[model samples]
Target: MNRFEYADNKFSEIEMMIAIPSFIIGVGILSLPQALASATTAMDGVFSILIAGGIVTFITWAIAKFAASFPDTTFISYASLIVSKPVAILLTFLFAIVFFSITAYQVRKIADISKQYLFDQTPVEVISLTFFLVIIYAVSGSRVGIIRLNMMFFPFILFIAIIVVIFNLNWFKFSNFLPVFQSNINDYLTGVNKSLFSFGGFGILWFYMAYVNKPNKAPKMAALGTGFPIALYALIFLACIGVYGESVTASMLYPTVELAKMVEIPGGILERFESIFFVIWIMAIFNTTAMAFDITVLAINLVFHHIPKIKIIFLLSPLIYAIAMYPQNLIEVSAFETFLNYAVFYYSIFVLVLLFVVAKIRGVKPSE
Candidate 1:
């Protein structure tokens, strides 16, 4: 068998479909309304999401095509094939750091949200540690297990989103979305940049595409995976704008969660809908963090080659925890998240373009 080809039958294309959207719809959703509102006014924010999502879709397609051409080998492996080992190692290692930083962002953001909304009495460290422990357990298992978890939790996440939008319709005002494109060119650019982070999770495609059972259809599946989130995000952003108005949405901390709080069932049985929303939303975060955590370990193993994955998982947990705890307040967390958003956006484009150019120059091709 070729070094890059494996007969592992763990993940089907359907699971690939499940996994990508799960990663895309994570902690970012909570703040998307604010991010959008801050960038532009009214429905212009919705347009920003659509534009950003389209750009990310193209990026996903490029990554999918690149990965499928190299079958069963991740960026870490094939990058080394296309480029020199030292350069590949450096680039792949930087990608690993990007993924790890994402995991840490999720860890801290979820903990802060949970403490503010769910467990006010509990220490944030305790909450974050508990979440990290769950993530560690999930990633420590087979990669297929993480995909299965995504498949299981995605429906609840989707259902809650629909419910929030449905219940909040009473507050919707058509006038709120008026004056689209009123923002200056710079403002639209700012909004697009803000919206870019929401789509960053698609970068996982570079690593996960290697596991697809059918490589030929992988690009289509990858496109589908990314396309759905674009639609879903547009719907949620529109719902938030029509309900909250741009100014109010911008002022709010977590506009989507606030949208949930605005919901009222006819019977009033569910008092704290945002709390319920948070619970399901955490599953999305878990899917993202677990996969990224797994990829981080995979990248390290590619470099070290001899270290056991389990030991690497154990070793990296503390570093993740430390990073998770590093943000002392919401201000610091916001600053850290802003820096990461730019890093993810720029690095994804940089690495993809570099690998594609190098692969072409070197006439890199898969084994027959």
Candidate 2:
């Protein structure tokens, strides 16, 4: 069986950053602020954002260091070259499971949110199935096609989100953020721990670095990608806090959407502004799900030495949908969130350590 080949030289660093970060920013933008506010006091949520951003930035730098050293190898291949084959395969399987589970959890969250906010009477299975179909279609496309699709959709999503932010500015109360850092320091630390899950998708860069047309520029592009999401997340977190006092923000399930509901245009043409926000959010979610599907397809092709056929993509969809169905309630989903927090923390640390050890073993010098 022939291994699937990426079009040997396609994506520029800027394109890679655009595709990768658009995938990471989805649920994080909408849900993380509320989670942070609940874990810490609203004032401390800002501090938590700084901490989360620092941790992610440092870890991303380490991953880029490793990618720069190898230049033209995927993480799967690098694992074997650095470690023994057995260990490499074991690690790859572990990461595959992690990616699959994360994908399922995100899909499930999208389904639940859609049911509650957008389609109040729609069945969860139907909603999930519909999105699952879309993801399969996305994954079946060529790599360039997926990249083009992401670039096209991301700008519109950002524009709508910015409009939502502006329209809702009047609802913000500066007093809501007055008692910054008044909460217990432990709460702020815990909030940072929780927010790590929001930074999960950036690691996709580890796999894509191998395919980056300009390997020399990968590190800078990776940094830009990582920094962009962190900045966007911080602003969104502050917006949530400003609109909803820490107490109320902490209590709401989807505080960002709730804040959008509070948006009122001066002209009073529409009563519900949240629907507009939701449209953009749906696009964001699509980008994320497509990214996960893309990575999974790439990994499968590498492992099995065959291009992913359309049938394989179709077959995988129902499996993902099934796994997504297991989270029976919000509590179960919260458990998954907790699991994701620790998983990302440890994964980041392991990848950094492994990268350093590999670089020393390989005797790789830093790139100019």
Using lDDT as the measure, the top candidate is: 1
TM-score each candidate.
0.95, 0.91
Poorest 10 consecutive residues by lDDT, candidate 1:
1-10
Runs in model 2 with CA error above 4 Å? Answer: 1-9, 358-368
> Given candidate 2, what's the lDDT at residue 288?
83
Which digits, one per residue and each the tens of the lDDT, describe model 2 over residues 1-368?
45355554477878787876787777766778777888886578777777887777777766776776777777777777677567776766666666666678778888889888999999998998888787777777676667767788878877776777787788889998887667797898888876766876666776777877887787777767777677777777788888888888878888778877888878899878888888878888888877777776676666666654566576667788888998889899878867865675587578668757875788645434
- Which residue pairs collide, candidate 2? none
Clashes of each: 0, 0
| Local accuracy by lDDT, each model | 0.85, 0.75
For candidate 1, lDDT tens digit of each residue in 1-368? 22223246457877887788898888888898898898887889888888888888888877888788888876777888888789989987887898899889899998998888889899999999999999998787777778878889988888988989988899999999998779888888887887788888667777788888787787777778888788888899999899988899999898888898998777878777787888888888888889889888878887888999889999989999999899889999999998988898889888888988888898987766
lDDT for position 155 in model 1: 87
Candidate 1 regions off by >4 Å?
1-9
Clashing pairs in 1: none
